[model samples]
Structures are given as C-alpha cells and as structure tokens.
Target: MAVDAARDGVRSRAPARERLRAGGRISRAARYLFFGAVLGYFCIPMAAVLIYSFATRWTANVLPDGYTLDWWQATVSNPRIQSAFSTSMALATLTAFIDIAVVVPAAYWSRVRNARIRHVIEVAAAVPFALPYVVIAFGLMQFSGVVAPQFQGTFVLLVAGHAAIAFPFVYWAVDGAMAAAGIERLSETAEACGASPMQIVRLVVIPNISSGLVTGGLLSFAASFGEFAMAQIIGRGLDTVPLWSAEMIRSYSDTAGSYNRLAVVTLLTFAVLFVLSAVVVYWNRGQTVRLLPGAGASDEGGRR
Candidate 1:
C-alpha cells in the first residue's frame, strides 16, 4: 500500500513538471518572436532605403532593375550638400560641448549640496518639452532682439536655441548618473580626505559619471542635428542638413535621382549615429568595470 501510494505521488508530480517546462518554452518563444518582429519593423525600411539609393531603376519590382553609385557620387560632390552637412555637424558638436560644460557642474552641485535647487532646475529643463518649438523659437527671437540684436538671424541664435532645448537631455542624464554614483557620499568622502570642491568634481565625480556624459552629449547632438522648426525660424536661411533636405524634397520631388540622394544622406546619418552608439557602448563597458567594486580586479584575475 505504501509503494502504490508513492507511485501515485510521483505520477502526479511528473505531469506538473512537464506542464511547467512547456509553459517556460512557450514564454521564451513568444519573447523571441516579439523581439524579432520589432527588429524587422525598424530594419526593413532602412534596408529598402539603402537598396533604393544604389538602384539605377526600381519601379514596381521586388528588386532593383539595376544598381549604380551615381547618387552617392552626386551627394558627395554637391557643394550645397557639403556646406549643409558641415553646418549641421558644427552646430551639433558645439551644442554637445556647451551642454556638457554647463549641465555637469550644475547637476553635480545639485546632487551633492542643495537638493532644494534641483526642483527649480527640473522645471527649467522641462520648459522646452512643455512649450511648442515654434513658441520657443519666437520667444527666443524676441528676447534676442531686445537683449542682443546682433545675434538675430545668426548661428549664435541657432546654437543658443539648440542648447536650450537639449539641456534637459544632459541634465537628466547627469542627474541619474549622480544618483547612481552616490555623489553625496562620494563628495563627503573626498572632502574628508582634504580635497577641495573643484578637485572632488574633477577627480571623483567626472570619472564616475563618464557614461552619462557621453549619453547626454549624444542625445544633445542628435537633437540639434535633427531639429527643424526652430532651425527654420531662427536660422533665417541657414542651410543645415534638415533645411537642405526639406528643400531637396520640396523642390526636387519629381526630379530624377533626387530620392536616391536623400537616401544616401539618410544612410550617412544612420552611420554616424551608429558609430557614436558604438563608442558609447565601449566607453560604458570600461566605466562599468571601474564603477563596480572589485570588477576590474576580477576581470584581471580571470585574464590571468
């Protein structure tokens, strides 16, 4: 009777275990399916654009009738496109640097010393998102007219606008980094060691928050590069990439090879962003090793 009862128990438990295994498999399969679908959704359009850029003619076909490098050549050689690309690059780079210089210290100070001022900074950062781009541009234009008339319709105004709008990105990134790094504790420790405020920030704070700085800088750069509405208003005829791309589409929509050129530009932009992302990832890995206690030592031991 005892043996029979034990067999019955074992039989019941086996089915339950089998069902749990099956459910786990189904869950994993579903997750993989969802991930693949999302990947495809984003990648397909870009793949099509890349193909079209090289296509000599692709009308109502599954693939191009032929392929050529004419569009790439034209886009590279065009002086107007070159000028626009350079302008966008310069503006984005400047905005990223300015945001880093301004936001890092402010975020560090807020995190370490006066938490009360953080709310005010948060409100200021959120202002760009709360208001429309058009309104912001108009307001800036009016303000610049009164305060610095010479800055009107110049790259200075564009950079200022870009920096203002991109502020939130840098601020949020640095704030999160500060929190994660336990900036208050770190600052206290450094001070206890007789380090000055500047030394603490330069030596302890910045090194720990390098990942956030890169991330924020990248976001700021991307935002400035892609911004259109404010650039259109404040730029006053400045030929950034967005403005030039708009003009290309509006004026040459029907012209032969115009779309191919646009596709080339799109791919180039994607490449630049991808390279930046790669850099960030590589930098973050090093930062991860440095930030975690004993991680670097463990890695070195494993290597040995």
Candidate 2:
C-alpha cells in the first residue's frame, strides 16, 4: 500500500513539470512564428517583383506561369530607355565625383581646423532630409531664376539638385571615416613629420578613408539614380531612368506583359545597388586588416 501511494504521488507531480516545459516551448515557438511572419511580410513583395520580372503570366494564379526573357529584351532595346539610363548614370557619376571633391576637403577642414563650424555645416546638410522634396524643388525653382536665369530646366540644375539631396550622405560617410581613422591625430602626426597640409590630406587622409569615399560615392550615385521628384520638377524634359520608369508604369495597361518591363528595369537598378553594397562590405572587411601594419596581429594578441 505504501509503495503504491508513493508511485501515485510521483505520477501526480509529473503533470506540473510537463506543463512548465510545455509552456516554455510554446513561448519560444510563438516568438519564432512572430519573427517568421514579419520576415515573410517584407520578403513577399520583393520576391513577387523578382518572379514577375520573368513571369509571362501572373493573373488568376498563385505563382507566375511560363517564364520568359522577352520583357528584359524589349526594355533594353528601347532607345528612350537607353537615353534615360545614360542620363541617370551620368548624373549619378557626376554627383558621386562632386561629393568626393567637396566633402573630402570640407570634412577634413572641419575636423582639423574648425570643429564648431562642423555642427552648422552638418545641420545644413540635413536640410534635404528635414524638408520635403516638393519644398526643395520649389525653392530651387525660385532661386534658379535669380542665380542663373537661363540655367533653369537644364541638366546642370538636375545635377545640382541631386548633389544637394545627396550631400548629407557623403558628408556623414566622410565624417564617420575621419572619426574612425582618427584623422585629426594622423594629420597632426603628419604635420610633425614636416608634411604640408595638402600633402597630409593627399597621402595619409585619403588612403585611410578610401572606404568612406567609396561608400559616399555609391550612396550618392544610388540616390541620384532613383530620385524622381526633383527629376520630374527640376529636370522637366530630362528623362532620367526613374522618370522614364515612372512614366512607363503610369501608362501601362492591365495587359499581361506591361509590368514585366518595369519589373526588369527595377531589378536592374536593384542589382547595381546590391553590387555596390557588396563592394562596400568587402572593402570594410579588408580595411580592418590593412589600416595599420601588424594591427590585426596586435588585435589578436590583445584578445589572447
């Protein structure tokens, strides 16, 4: 009787233990489910875009049927598409170079010569981010008439607008690089070695912060490439890639292959941006190893 009573008591306690374990497992499963749901929510759209790019038919179907490259071929063969692409590339390239030319010197000067003015300039850079594109577009339109009355509706205005909007990105990138590489201290050391200011910048500063320059350049290029509002407003007749894409999408009927061209163009842009991002990642990884001679070795030693 005593043995049976002890066995019954153990059996009674087992449910409580199992219940606690089950509750923990349920909580963990719920967490995973929630995160998975969020991931799927964001990914479905991009995946749909990718699928639609190659899809011959998608209507009334859960998945696209009959993949084809015809849309990609058509989009590429269009002369207007080519011109718009060229305009976007040219504008982006110019903006990137301009950003490097201006931000590099300006950031270095702010760090080495005057720290107080950095705040003011940084705030100025944020103007594009703080204000809406419509507001900036209106302001630019108004000022262009006063500054260069004949320059309105020109490609120069478009480039200038893109550069202005992209300034913050370039400035922030270069500034971050300067801070990370301790450029001010490096500059001082170079000065102590009898190097001129320009020499210090050209040699020590530029080499150390090359990653930042590339990042800023890529970001500027991407921003300029995709910018629509300013292009539509300031550019007027200038049909950059984004404007062209927008026009095409707007005019597209509910036909089977109409969206395919737009999707292909979008995918192309995405691929370019993705490649640039990958390059930046690769550079950053290599940079950590190359920044100082034996720097990696010393880090390993310190960790040990």
Candidate 3:
C-alpha cells in the first residue's frame, strides 16, 4: 500500500514538470510567430520597392528581363525634382528647429506652472493630430484670404502648415523626457544652488533632456518632410516631391519607365528618413549608456 502511494506521487510530479516544459515551448513558439509576422509585413513591401526600383520591365513577367539605372539617372537629372528635393530638405530642417524651440519651452513652462494648465496645453498640442487634415486645410484656406493674404502660397505658409502638424510629436517627446528625468526635482536643486531660471535651463535642463530634444527634432523633421495633404492644400499649388510623384502616377504611360522613376523617388525618401532614424537610435544608445550607473567607471576601465 505504501509503495502504491509513493508511485502515484511520482507520476503526478512527472506530469507537472512535463506540462511546464510544454507550456514554455508553446509560449516561445507563439512569440516567434508573432514577431515573424510583423517583420514580414514591413520587409515585404520594402523588398518589392527595392526590386522594382532597378527593374527595366516588371509587367507581364515574374521579374524584370533587364536591370538598369536609367530611371535613377533621369530622376537625378530632372531640374524639377532637384528643386523639390532641396526644398524638402530645407523646409524639414527649418521646421524641426522651430518645433524644438517651441515645444521645449512650452513643455517646461506647463510643468512648472500647474497641473490644470499642463493638461490644457497637452490637449491643445494634440489638436493638430486629432483634427482631420481636411478640416485644418479648409480652415487655413478659408482664412488665407483674410488673415494674411501676402503669406498665402509662399514657403512661409508651407512651413507654418508643417510646423502645426509636427508640434504634437515634439511636445510629447520632450514632455515625456522631462517627466522621466524628474525635471522638477532637478530645477529645485538648481534653485537651491542660487541658479536663475535661464541658468537652470541652459546648464541643467537642456543637458539632461538632450536625447529627447534630438529625437523630437528629427521626428518633427520627418513628419514635415513627408507631409502630403497639408502641402497639397495649404501649399497653394506648391511643387513638392509627393505632389510630383502623384502626378507621375496619375499620368502613367504604357512604358514602365514612369513606374520605375516613381519607385526611385520613393526609395530616395525612404533612404533619407532611414538615415535620420539610424542616427537617432545610435544617439539614444549612447545617451542610455552615459546615464547608466557606474558608466564612467566602465569607460575608465576600458581606457586603461
């Protein structure tokens, strides 16, 4: 009877261990499957674009019969494309700078003032993101004639439109960083040391939140660079890369050259944004390492 009882206990323990092992294996399998699906979803479209960019002909065939750089060359040589590309780069940089300048101060002020004010400002910052693009565009157009007639159809308005859309991204990025860094405590410390508001901002606040500032600025720049709807309506017939690409697609010819050219433009935009994103990622890693405990000691040891 004792032997039978012992046997039963052993059997129960064996099944429990096996069940845990099976559950772990299933969990890992599910995680891999989920990630694999996500990876494929993004990579598949990018792979298609890359392949099509070099193809001389794709229609009615599994792959291009020939490959050529003629489309890329043509795109590079086109004066209109050159102008639009430069315009986008310049506008994106300017818009990003403006966003940084505006968002950082506003976020800091709201935090320093009161909770109600901060909430109100946060809602206001999100207005552009929440409102439909059509509504914003129409409102801008409606007021363009009356508010600032001379400003309409100029680069100023284009920058303004881009800035409006990009502000929320900048605001959230910097605001979150401030909160995470415990800006209020840091400010109190600075005040205890007899630092002025300006001194605290320049010496303490900016340095601590530098990572967030870079991230926010770059994100805002990318947003402005790729904005289509606002540029189309608020730009008042501006010749942006997106608008030009749309026109090319609309007036497609029987030949595959047009499609190839469009693909090249698309890839160019992707490459630029990809580089910026990579920079941000690398910078963030460095920031994280620097902020980690005993990071300086590790660095000194490595140097030795």
Candidate 4:
C-alpha cells in the first residue's frame, strides 16, 4: 500500500514538471522571435543600402541588374570628397583632444576635491541635451558676432561649438570611470603618502581612468564628425563630410548614380565609426587586468 501511494505521488509531480518545462521552452522561443524581428527591422535597411552602393543599376527590380566598383572608386577619388573627408577628420580629432583635456581634469577635481561642485558641473554638461543643436548653433553665432565678428564661419568657431556639444560625452565617461575607480579613496591614500594633487591625478587617476578617456574621446570624435547644424551655420565656408553629402543629395538629385556615391560615403562613415568603437572595446578589455588588486606587483614579479 505504501509503495503504491508513493508511485501515485511521483506520477502527479512528473506531469507538473513536464508542463513547466514546456512553458519555459515556449517563453524562450518567443523571446528569440522578438529579438530576431527587431534585428531584421534595423538590419534590413542597412543591408539594402550596402547592396545599393555596389549595384551598377538597380531599378524597380528585386535585385540589381549588375554590380560594379565604379561608385566606390569614383566617390573615393573625388577631390572634393577627399577634402571634405580630411576636414571632418581634422575637426573630429581636435574636438576629441580638447574635450579630453578639459573634461578629465574637471571630472577628477569634482570627484576628488569638491562634491558640492558636481551639481553645477552636471548641469553644464546637461545643457547640450536640453537645448537643440540649432539653438546652440545660433546662440554661438550671435555671441561670436558680438564679441568677435571676425570669427564667424571659421574653423575656430566650428571647433569651439563641437567641443561644447561633445563636452558632456567626455564629462560623463570620466565621471563614471572615476566613480568606478573609487578616485576619492585613491586620492586620499595618495595624499597620505605625501603625493601632491597633480601627482596623484597624473600617477593614479589618469592611468586608472584611461578606458573612460578613450571611450569619451571616441564618442566626441563621432559626434563632431556627424554634426551638421552647427557646421552649417557656423562653418559655412568649410566643407565637412556631412555638408558634402547633403550637397550631393540636394544639388545632384537628378544626376545618375549620385545616390550610389552617397551610399558609399555612408558606408565609409560607418566604417570609421566601427573602427573607433572597436578601439574603445579593445582598450576596455585591458582595464580588468589593470584594476585587479596587486596587478602591478604581479607584473613586476613575473618580469623579474
């Protein structure tokens, strides 16, 4: 009688467990379906653009009649495009450098020295997001007009504007990195060891937060590279990539194969951003080793 009753209990629980397993499988399948749908939604358009860039003649057909490298070659070899690309690169590099120089020290000081000032710093950083790019661009234009009219439509103004807008990226990155590194505690320790503020920042803070610096700098570079409104208003004389692409779209609307060249430019921009992102990821992969306790000592011992 006892054995029979035990078998009955086991049979009852087995069906419940089976039902749960089936339900879990259904739920997982649903999640995968949703993910795939979302991925397809975003990826399909980009794939189309990529295909069109290589297509020699794509009409109303399902596929291109043929494929050729003419678009890529023509777009890359165009002197105007080359000039625009170089200008964008130079502006992006300058913006990234300026942001890194300003934000790293400001963030470090706010985190270690004066927590009270952080609110003010955060508000300043948030200004770019709160205001539209057009507003900022016009405001800078007006301000520059008043203080220095000679600076209007100059690369100097463009760099200043880019730096202003890209400031938040570097600030937030460095601030997060400093928090993660526990800069306050590190600073205190260094101070106890009779290290000066500059020494502490140079020796301890910067090294620990190098990942953040690179991430921030790359983000700033990407932002500056794609910026249009400020560049349009304040950099009228300059020919950046975005401006050139816009001109191709607007002025050459009737020109055959114009879109293919534009598509090539778009892909090139994506490639540059991808490379920068990969750099940041590669830089971050080393942070774990650097942050581990006694990592420096371990390295020295291993070397010896």
Candidate 5:
C-alpha cells in the first residue's frame, strides 16, 4: 500500500499538496455560497413567522410597521388556541410512539430479508409522501366513508391520518441511517453472540440510530402539527392547531387580533421543536464514536 501510494503520487501531474492548495480556494468559495444560499432560503419563512407573530402592525409594506407582544398574550389567553395546541401535542406524541415501534423493526427486518424488498418497503413508506396532503386526505376520507364509517369523526381518525403522513419520514430517516452505517451487521453480530434478537435491537440498533430516530420523530411531529388537510377532511371537531388557525383566518379577517394570536401560537411551536432538534443534533455530535461504522459494535461478549 505504501509503495502503491508512492507510485501513484509520482505519476500525478502535480504534487497533491500543490494541487490541493491551488484549487481549494475556488472549491471552498463555491461550497460557502451554496450553503449560504440554502441557509438564507430556510431563514426566510422562519423570519416571516417570527416577525409577523410579534409585529404590532401590518400594511402594504414588505416589512411589518411595528412589533409587540399583544399577539403572544392573545394567543395564550384564548381557550380555543389552548385546545388546539393541546390536541396537536397529543397527536404528535402519539405519532412518535407509534413511529418508533414500527420504523426500526421494519427497517431492520427489511435489511435482514432482502435489499430489493427493502426498496419496495421504502417505496410504500414514501408513496404517501409524494402525494399532496389534500389529495391523500380526500382519498382517505372517501375510503373511510365506504370501508369504516365508525372512524369518520374522531381523535383515532386524526391520529391514523397523521401517522400515515408522518410514517414516511420516520421510516426513511432511520432506514437511511441504518443502511449507511452497517447497523444490520451490528445486530447480526450481537445475535450470534447469545444476545436475543430483541436485546440486540434494543441495545445496539436503537443506540446507534437514536438521534436519527428522534430527528425523524420530530419531523413527523412537526409535519403532523402543521397539517391542515387531514384535519379538515376527517378530524371532525377535534381541531388540531393548523386546522384551528386556518378556520380563524377564513372566519375572521375582520379580526386581525385573532390572526396575530394564531401566529404567536405557531411561533411558540416552532421555537420548541427548533430547540429539541438542536439538542438532538448536539447530543449526537457529542457522542461521536457511535456514528462511525462498527465503531461501537463490539462488546465483552466478543463482536456482540
């Protein structure tokens, strides 16, 4: 390997050090600009939501005329807003629990069974993802109308719909992480060493994908939280936050105060999720060893 490296080094047009030094400046600049553009695009919506939530006045101007906490106070004080927020939270928490159980085992089993089958499973997971929310919600509602009338208007219907949308996120996210990092080998090796399949999965697979899992769950939660179509179509009167906000906008244009209050609620939801996502990212980075392929795969029980 050393000799091959030396031969390859000598055959090159320029010394690697000089070539790297000469071209790195242009490459780095391109990378910076690419990332800066992406970041700016993400910041725009968030900035709008935050600024408008606090903005005391609005007009034809591009920016808010002023800012205040009246929106926050009104949002918090409104019992309707509180009810909607609570509903969203409950729905999200339920989705997270359902996702964690289903996604990991399915991903691991798909990997264990066949990679081509894995592709099929992934497609199923993502099929709903590609569809517009309203299209799927209407389909679900129509299907439910014929197949199961009992679920027409209830929290159960909302959760199932939310899970359908959120499932794609959790499945793909953790599945991608596991596939990229040889997580199956970790589990396979564990089971070979007298570890039960359940133990191997619980201790090894879960730890490695914990961050990805949580991140996926968070994405699912956020997706469910802001969901408008599912709730409108089939959630009945159990208004999730987004449905409530949309109704407020439609019903009360004369009531800008209500709009402001909805904006404040949205801002708060964003803040909480943003903080949780940051913490998950930070925690994973700090525990960096497990991220490497097979980095923490071995154990006292030999290769477990």
Candidate 6:
C-alpha cells in the first residue's frame, strides 16, 4: 500500500512540475511579443512628438528636416500657451479633488458589504462612462440654466461638469481595487482594534487602495485637462487648455510657426497624460503584486 501510494504521489508531482515548466516557457515567449508591441506603439508617437518639438518643420517627408530649438522657444515663449497650461493645471486639480471627495467614500460604502449595493452603484457608474460628453454637456446646460441658474456659465458649473464626468473614473477603479483586497478580514480586524468606521477608512483602507485612487485621480485629471467640447460649449471665455488650444488652431492655420507651436502644445499635452498614465500603471502593478498570489493569479482568482 505504501509503495503504491508513493508511486501515485510521484506521478502527480511529475505532471505538475512539467506543467509549471511549460507555462513558464510559454509565458516568456508571449511576454516578449506582448511587451514588444506595447512598447513600440507607445514610444512611436512620443518619439515623433519629441522629433517634431525640436523640428523646425514637421511635414510628411522621408525624414524630419533635422532638428531646431526654435519650435521649443516658440512653444515656451507663447503667453497663450502659458495661460492654457495654468488653466489646465487649476481645472484638473479641482476636478480630481472634487471627484475624490465624492467617489472614494461612496465606493467604500458600496463595497465592504453585501455586494448588491456595490453592483447597483457599479451599474450607475457605467452611465457616465457610456454617456457622450455632448449629451452630458447639454444636460448640464439644462440643469444649470433652470434649477441652478446661479451656476450657469461660471467656474462652479465647469467644476461640477468636470466632477460628474470624473466620478465614474475614481469610483470604478477604487471599487475594483477594494473588491480585490479581501475586504471582510481587513474591515473586521480594523473594527476589532477599536477603529471607528471613518478611521478604518482614513488610515487602513485608503492606504491599501492608494494606487487605485491615484490612478483614478490622474485619469480624471487628464480627462478634465483635455476636455474641450464641454468647456467650449459651457465656458466660452473661461478658456481651459483644450478650449484655448482649439480656439488657437481654429483661428490660425496660415502660419507654419503657429502650427508648429500648436503641435508642440499637443505634444506637451500627450506627454503629460502619457507620464501620468505610466505612473498609474506602475502603481497599479505594485498594488497587484501586494494583493494577488502572483502576477497571473488575478485572472484565475476572479473565477474562484
């Protein structure tokens, strides 16, 4: 009986080891291809931007006309560019701040419980994600013009518009993080240790899910920063970066220098968002490492 049992165990071990080795080999090959494609795609446009930012001329040619610092100076010295940047910074800050206040606690409440409420909130959150900006903007115009006439065509309305759109971003990202975090034990442990609900969230939960919050916040910032239609339609003279950039482009296409400067601005916008996104991805990776058994376990654990 001992011999037979030992043989059976050895047989099981052999297949398990074989499967593990095979998977590792397969993953290495797939990783190379997947990472290569991703790196290539992301780097290409930014490379073009960097090239163009320095290029005196950015046209469809075999190669760029070498490089020059004049475009750099043109972009740097423009007062309009400076104003747009300041507006973008201020607007994104307010949007992220407001969204955080609303979304984080709501996500925590919706999660850390029976999941039915979370499911409902998740569905509601999807509404903004799916709705067109045009529709949202129109709705805002309607609401602000009537019930909240004091908000119409003001910073209050603009911030509110940004916050509404940003809510779903923070809510979904943080909610997904909380779901992955093995919520019950953490909440129970915190409660047992004489922690109030608010304290449990402020210190324990938020730190653990910081990555998601940061990611969601950055994405919200980017969305608000790049918002044009809503700002243009709502904030005609208020002039956030995207709106101002659009206005500049619309008004001036005759001058090559102006276009080059605009391209530089575009590059700057893309770079900022790209860097922010990269930071979020890195942070999310860290969160995944902390929570999951291993890198591949997350996809499998969901089914479990």
User: 248-288, model 2: which lDDT tens digit per residue?
Assistant: 78886747466888898888888887887677667777443
Error of 2 at 113 (Å): 1.0
Quote the positional error of residue 267 for candidate 4 in Å: 0.1
The TM-score-based order of candidates, best leading, equals 4, 2, 3, 1, 6, 5
Candidates 2 and 6 compared by lDDT, better number: 2
Clashes of each: 0, 0, 0, 0, 0, 0
lDDT of 3 by residue, 50-136 (tens): 888888888878778888888889989999999988988888999999988887877888777666766776566556756876678
Tally clashes: model 6: 0
TM-scores, in order shown? Answer: 0.79, 0.82, 0.80, 0.82, 0.73, 0.75
Model 4's alpha-carbon lDDT is 0.82
Ranking the candidates on lDDT from highest down gives 4, 1, 2, 3, 5, 6
Better lDDT candidate (3, 4): 4
Model 2 lDDT, residue 120, Cα? 79
Candidate 4 wrong stretches, greater than 4 Å: 1-30, 252-255, 281-304
The per-prediction CA RMSD against the true structure, in angstroms, equals: 9.7, 10.5, 10.1, 10.3, 8.8, 8.6
Which is better, 1 or 3, measured by TM-score?
Answer: 3
Error of 2 at 154 (Å): 1.6
Predicted candidate 4 versus true structure: per-residue lDDT over 161-267, tens digit per residue: 99999887777667767877998999999999999988998999999988788888888899999999999999998999999888878865533888899899988
Better of 1 and 2 by TM-score: 2
Candidate 5, TM-score vs. the true structure?
0.73
lDDT of 5 by residue, 80-163 (tens): 878888888999889877877877787888887567766776567655656788888888888999999888978888788888
Highest lDDT: give the candidate number.
Answer: 4
Where is model 1 poorest over a 10-residue stretch in terms of lDDT?
4-13
TM-score of 1: 0.79
